[model samples]
Each structure stands twice: as structure tokens, then as C-alpha cells.
Target: MTVFRLPDLGEGLTEAEILEWKVAVGDVVTVDQAVVEVETAKAAVEVPVPIAGVVTELCAQAGSVVSVGEPLIAVGVAENSETARYREEEQAGSGNVLVGYGTSTAHRSRRRARPTAPPPHGRVPRVISPMVRRLAKEHGIDVAALTPSGPGAIVLRKDVEEAIAAAARPPETVDEVRVPLTGVRRTMADRVSRSRREIPDATTWVDADATRLVKLKRNIRNTDPDARVGMLALFARICVAGLRRFPELNAHVDAERHEIVQVKGVHLGFAAQTDRGLVVPVVRDAHRLTLAELATELARLTDEARAGRLSPADLTGGTFTLNNYGVFGVDGSTPIINHPEAAMLGVGRVSEKPWIHKGKVRSRQVTQLSFTFDHRVCDGGVAGGFLRFVADCVEHPEALVTHL
Candidate 1:
């Protein structure tokens, strides 16, 4: 029998909640086939089968939380079979097969710490785990050059402290700053810091007359009684339509690999404000839903998120994100892109203003639309066009009604 443990999905992710199982006991599964969907703190990811065999048992049930290294499933293989023979050979050090997230037996061995002694033959020495040694090799760093500061002559985490720290100047004392880095502040700080350091962002703002849209929403609320469309719903609808026209905006920047991934589907993320922090629950396939449907989903998602009942799946797979800072009494602001996504739109509050309408000064509800995009994937022209499309849609609400 082959035991499949829940794999580490990402850095620092220890446990995951089993959201669904694609296979059941007695079902045959092939290697690398998706067998379950697990929800972690970061996102919902599908776990694949590690071996080809009939599932003998499921150790965890749906909605049950499991930690790493805990067996999730057991697959039964035939005795003296090709897979079993290969496993025996692997146990004998003939190279183990890496399937799904399975690690090799070589990684399971414990390393002995170095003894306290003077330099041996004038050679530098270091103590580290087998995993750290492999990581050092992959990073082209000399492990022997590092000093071990851990107990029992082992290299603890601090041993890899910044190489240039010794030569750096000490900082002068300043006023102490202390604040709780939890909830919204922490998330905003991390996102903004990363965006400032990693992404080359450029923002464009366009002031548009949203009078027609506001009037349309008011009319809908009055007529339907059950259908209440807000400005955010209209904005989401406009963004979906704009993406169809300019698909390049609906993309993600893979900075590590230096690639821009354009997604085909429209998973729109709406920034919902709560007392704790701002949560963005995504509406999968927002383009497929009508304005009313989008409004309803947005309402439901916000309600669930505020109630702390949002599942991990509701937060992932967002191709585009929209932040309505206008609801907070802000006129306009540049919003940071959700990591892995290339662009984000900030919708400002709609306020009545006097504007020149066909050679006459008239009152109109004007709102500012801010588009912040990763310059690496999008240029000024593309970003401007997307903003213009949204502005046009909001100004002419009839267009959205006809299109939908």
C-alpha cells in the first residue's frame, strides 16, 4: 500500500481544509491526476494523485482540516508488481520516482552536526540540514563559507544572516513606532511594499459622467423592488465588457519567470470594505453574468466575507480586481494590483458636478476611474483605452443594458 501525505502547497502553509474529493475509495487513479481540492490560507489548490493504483482508504473527509506529512489517502498496489518492484528498487537507492509532491528517500536522512574544533586542513566549514544544503547548491552559494550559530553545531536560520551585515553601519536611534500589524493594515502594507519594490506600476485617471448609470440604478431599484443595482455592480459589469474588448488588461505578471499570462476567463474581484479589513471576493466568470446577477453575487460574497464564512475558493482565480474607494468618501486613489494579477481599477465616488453639456452647463454625476497597471505587460495606450471603455459604458448606461 502506498500512503499519500498532504503536500506542502506553498511556503509556510502547514494545514489545508479538504474542500472536495474527486475520487473515492475503490476508484483507480493515475499519477498526477487531480484527486482532491484543498483550501489553504492563501488559495484553493487541487491535489494530484501520487501513485497509480486503487484507492484503499481516504484518511480525511470533506471539510476536514489536515496538516502536512499526514496521510491523506492510501493506494493499494499489487504485490511484486511493476510499481512495487520499482518501489523496492527505490528503497535500495536506485533513485526514487518523484510523483505529485512526493519527496525522495534521500531527503529523509538526518545530518550529524559538526564537532567543535579548529579548521581542518585550513578548509572552511558549515553545518546545515540536507534540505538547506540542496537549496544552497541550487542557489550557487557556498555552504562551507557560512557560519553555523545553531545549537549542537548545526546551522540555525540566523546563520544565513545577510552576508554584508558585518560591514554595514549601525542605525541612529529614532522615535519608536509601534502599531498592530494585523488585519487590513498588515495586508495593505505588504501589498504596497511589494508593489513599490517589484512592479513597475503606472496609473491613469479619467473623470467620467456617471449620471446615466446612477439614474439607471435608481430606476431599477424603484421598479424591480427585488433587484437593487449599485455603482459597484455597474462598474464590475463595465470592467467585464472592457476586458472582452481589451483582453490584454486581464492578465497576470509572472515576475520570477518574466512572463505575462493572459487569462481567458473573467474572474472579477470586488473590493469589499469591512470593519476588520478590505476583502476581495471574486466572482468567477463575471462576464457570463448579467448586471443584476453580478450585483447579487457581489452582495452575497461581501456578506459572506464580512461574516467570516468565505471559503478559500472565493478568494482565488481573480484575473482583475476593482477597488471602490469612493464609498469611503475618497475622490480618487491609485490602488495596488493584487499579487499575480497585472492590473486593478479604483472607482471613485460619484458626485454631482456642473459640466458643459452640448454647449450648455448642466448638472451631472461625475466619478473618477483610476487604472493602475504593470507597465511590463501593458503600455499607456492599452491602459488608456480600457479606462475610456469603462467611462463610455458608465456615461451611456443604455449600452450596458443592450449588450447584456
Candidate 2:
């Protein structure tokens, strides 16, 4: 018997939720055949069967979360069959042992099902993490009164807190009912935490007059009824130009290999705020796309991200990231660097501001650009120069057409 274990889907992910199982017991699977779909923090990926054989048992059911090195499925192989030979080959290390290994099918365990009993009046079913349960008990909150927001009616930490807060309010006061954070929300938290702790971030801010860019967008909107030029698309173009001027900023810092992997094409990730959480979807080869094309792709990505229809591939291979915090009426903030990437750009809120131009005071539409870089890979001078280049492009919107 050959056991299939959950594999690491990259980005140091140690566990994944079983989104679906493509194969069932008594079904035959071929080598490299996708047997299950698992969702990690980064994305959802299909895991393939290593050895061809009949599936004997599936340990984890759909929607069940499994840790790394846990046995997921068991494949039964004939004693003298080709699958047995392949298993032997795999054990001998002849075949690649990539990242995750196969599980041992010696014994299989079943997961316990949740109780189906209806709760009493004015009480909600609680589905909570082990840690949250202990915390709730300590806080004197009734766990049974908390509604579960986890997968398949499970309880979460946020659910417990919201329940406690609602319980504290008066009966006459209507509270906004709590909703569980799932799918994208869970994934975003993991990725953001990883990026924050792993990357060394440094930020530099510069103010620029976006008067010309705003006017150009207005002209486009006037000429073409369907054209909608947002600040993000304009900034994306500027990022591509800056990346072209300094190719070093367009590279990934591979710390394990101790090498800088320089990318030829420009793939920019636009950070969009969705109802679930912040998701950054990539626009591949932004340098080759025209302003209209960039606008279209950005719109599409933003819509998909907001709708939670983004695929795994849509979120990968980002050379750089842009966060437009200006829309929320905030001046500037030190944005966190996306891991592996050297830097990230934050566009602050744009508003009318007084400035001295040609020794004359004038009000202009100005915004602050915050460029956050990984200090380990880039110096202050290099980071400043890149920000200056981006600011110059934004200030002179007409110059972008020539580069395009």
C-alpha cells in the first residue's frame, strides 16, 4: 500500500484545507494524476498521485484541514505490479522527493462529526478554535451562545469576540450580527503576517503634483465614454517606467539560493480592497500594455478580486506591488513590503495643496508617494532614486506616452 501525504504548495505553507477530492476509494489513479485540490495560504492547488494504483482509503474528507506530513489517501498496489515497482523506485529515492512525502497507510483515522442538536432560544451554536475556547471561558463568555463563522459551521476567534461584545450591549440596542471570515480573509491574514515578519522594510515618502495626470484622465473620460482612468492604472504605468530605468528593482531576492533573480517582463500587483480582505492580483507584462489595455486589465482584476472569483494563477508572480491608500483620505503610511519582492509603492490621498511654483504660491492637486523597500537587498540611495523616478513620471504625465 502506498500512502499519499499532503504536500507543501510553496511559500513555507505547513497546512492546507482539502477543497475537494477528485478520486474516491476503489478508483484507480495514474502517476501525476490530480487526486485532490488543497488550498494553502498563497493559493489553491491540485495535488497529484505519485504512484499509479487503486485508492484503498481516503483519510481526510472534503473541507477538512490537514497538516504537513499527514497521510491523506492510501493506494493499494498489487504485489508484483508496475505500481509496486514504482513505489519501490520512489522509496529508493530514484524518483524526485520534491517537497512533501507520501503518507503511511498502516492505519487510518476518521474525523468526528459535529453535533446536529438545535440550540436553545437566544443562544447561538459555537464553533471556535481551541485557543479561543480557553480564552472565552476565562472571559466569562458563554461559548454556546457564540455563532460559528468557520467552515461548515465552525466557530472562530472573531466570532467569540463579537458574540461577547454583542452580549454586553443592552437588549434594546440592535447590534450588527457577526459574520465569519473565510476563504480569502483567512488566506490574506496568513500572507500578510508572513510578509511582515519575514521582510525587512524601509519607507521613503515624496510629494508630487498629479494635476496633469488627473486632467489627462478627465480628457480620456470625455473623449471615450467607456474609458475610466483611475489613479491606480496611472501609477502602474509609472511603476513600469521606473522598473525599466532600474532593472534591479524588478528582481526577486532569493535568500535561500543567495541570488537575485532578475525578471525581464514587468508584472505589477495592484492591491484592491475587497469585502473579504485586501488581495493583490497581478497584471503580467505591464510594460508592454498600452494605457487603455492597462486600464481594462486593472478593472477586470479589481472586479474579480472584489467578487472573490480570482484564480490561483491570478495572484502569483508579482514583481512589484502598489497600494493606493490615498482613496481613504490618508496622507502617507509606511506600507509593508510583499515578501520575496524588494519593494512596494504606496500612493497617499490626493488633495488640493499650496505649493511654491516659480516663486509664486499656488494650490495644486498633490499626493504623497511612499516607497517601502527591503533594506537587506536595497540601500537608501537606490530606494530614493526609484521613488524620485516614479514621482517624476507622475508629475509629467505626457512623458509616459513617449515611453509607452
Candidate 3:
């Protein structure tokens, strides 16, 4: 039995949730054939089998999560099976096989970390990693002249570069920082850097009386559990209503066209903080969804987001974003605009505080809402209006229908 282990989808995700099994036991699969859809923290990806054979065992059930490097499927190969002939032809053409995540191409054999060495060297030492040789060649530095610095007396890239640098000038003190920009962190770095570089962003904020919104949610929960609205859904509805009044905040700046692209629909994305990282899963056509529908979707997407089961489609094409930093028990935050979109609405935690509602002083639920916008799309007037509209809706949820 040939075991096909689960492969790393990306971003060094250690585990994946099996969403579906495409092939059952006794079903035949070919090279690079997708056998299952597994969801990583970033997206749902179809994991493919690397060999051609009859499926013998389905190691994981649908919805069960499995770790990387664990056997995902087992395939039985007969002597006369096409897998042998396919592998033979594959060897003749290319030495390796495609594994997972649709990374199929001419699979070239990766070089070993070090090359073979001579038995006894009258010269300096052995070289490790072909990169060391390449570095030495590029700099006209002789490996035999420099002492090996790594384990097993092997010449390293750093050693070669240091030798060249020492030859260039005497060792000098310098200040420089280096880091690996990779995975989701790398993606965030790129997007944030681009946003800072490209978008002229500005932030504005205001405090809202969320007592009525809280009371409304509480009343709904008390009466009907199924129709209850979450704070996120309430804010989402208000945001959609605000966007209707101040549509400029719900637009994107088109670089090529040099115009503000106003989106007709609200693909509302909410910031979901997870163990992996902060990901925004968009609820498509959110403006059309009722409060109950929005609550359901928000709950489902939030669950999927936590499970790392959101697909790529769920992560992109957002018209606007809602960030509730209050879940972390904070008052407010100037949320960064998810690029391509002009604005983001931030909700801080609602807390009990002394306030004068009507003629009497009492403790009421209060929360701060932060609104950030791209300066290119609109100025302070438009931003302030959008923010005030949202606040008004939060302070009095009745403004929702009027704006809609």
C-alpha cells in the first residue's frame, strides 16, 4: 500500500480539516488527482494524490482534521497496474512527481545540500550547498584558500561571502536589519506596505450610546433565540445604511482609470482574529441580507474563519470592512483600511458608564466607533458624515430603514 500523506497547503499550516472526500475506497485515482478538499487557515484547498492506484483506505473522514505528514489516503498497486509504467515513463521524462495544491509541473529533482567530495584534499575543505560554490565563483574567491566554518568541515555561503567581504575591506561595524518575509505574515507585510505607500489614509472616531442596540439584542434573544442579532450584525446593518447615505466611503480608487470606483453592493468583510492571524472573511452582498441572515452568516463565517476553513472567495473583493477590536476589551482603534477598499469601520467594546439619558443620570452601554478612509476617495466632510450616520444608527437603530 502506497500512503499519500497530507501536504502543507501553505504558510506552514500544521493541520488541515478534511472538507470532503472525492474518492471512496476501491476507486482508482491518477497522478495529481484531487482526492480531497482540505481547509487551511488561509483557504480551502483540494489536496491531490501523487500516485496512480486503486484507493485502499480513506484515512480521514469528512470534517475530521489531520496533521501534516500524516497519511491521508492509502492506495494499493498491483504489479500490472499503470502506476509502475507511469512512474517509468515519468522517470524517463522527469524524475519527480507533483504532490499537492495543484503545484503540478515538470517536477525537477532537488539538489542535495552538499556535493560529493574528494577522499583526501591537499586543499582547504569540502563545500556544503551549491550556493557556496556559486557565491565563491561570483566573487572570484577560492574555496581552497579559506577555512570551512560549518559542521563537518564544509564551506558555507556565509563563509564564502565573509571571505570576499574581508578581502574587499577590513571588517567594519554596520547597522542593518534582516527578517524572513514569508507566509501570511509576508502577505500582510506586502499589503500593508502597499497600502501605506499607495493610499493616503486618515482616521476619525466618535463615541456612541449603544444602550438601545444592546437592549434590542437582549429583547430579541429573550423572545426568540433564532432571530437574535449579534452586535456585529447590528453594526453591519448600520454600516450598510451609512454606506447608502455616504456612498463615497464604500468606493475604491482605481489606479489605472484614475477614478473612484463606487461599488453597487456591500461585500461586507469583518476582521476575524484567529490563532493563525487576523483574517477578513467577506459576507457577499451583505446589504441584501437581513439582520437574521447577517447574524447567521457572521456566525458561520466566524466559525469557518476560526477553523481555517474559509475559501479564497471569502477573503477578497470587499467593498468595506468592519473591525470590532472591542472583543479584545479595548475602547477603540484606528483600523487600517483593507486596500482596494476606501474605508473601514472599527467597533470598540461596549462598556457600562455613567451617562445622562433623558433627564436622569444612569449607567448605560457605550462604545466607540472608529472610521478610517482613503483621502483620495473623500475628504473629512464625507468621512465625518459617514461616521455620524453609523453612530446615529447605533444610537438609534431606526435610521437603518430610512437610509436603506
Which residue runs of candidate 2 sit more than 4 Å off their true CA positions? 1-181
The candidate that wins on lDDT is 3
The lDDT per prediction is 0.75, 0.76, 0.77
Clashes in candidate 1: how many?
1
The better-scoring model by lDDT among 1 and 2 is 2
- Measured with C-alpha atoms, the lDDT of residue 7 in candidate 3 is 58
Candidate 1: tens digits of C-alpha lDDT, residues 1-404: 98777765656666776655777777776656667766565555777664677878889865466887688889896654646654664355432222234322223112221223444676643445444455456555565677654332444333433433432548768999797888655865686688778888899999999888888889988887676688888888888888988999899888688788999999999888776677778999998998889989999999998897877788778999999999988899988888768899999889989988879999989999999998988899999999988889988978865556
lDDT of 2 by residue, 25-92 (tens): 77776666667766555545667676666879988865566887688899886665656665676555
Instruction: Report the C-alpha lDDT of model 3 over 98-213, residue by residue, as the tens digit.
Output: 23443344442222112324336545335344444666888999888888654335555567778888899967789989967665556666777788889999999999899989
Single out the weakest 10-residue window by summed lDDT for candidate 2: 105-114
Q: What's the TM for model 3? A: 0.55
Clash count, one per candidate: 1, 4, 1
Better of 1 and 3 by lDDT: 3
Q: Pairing residues by index, what is the TM-score of model 1?
A: 0.54
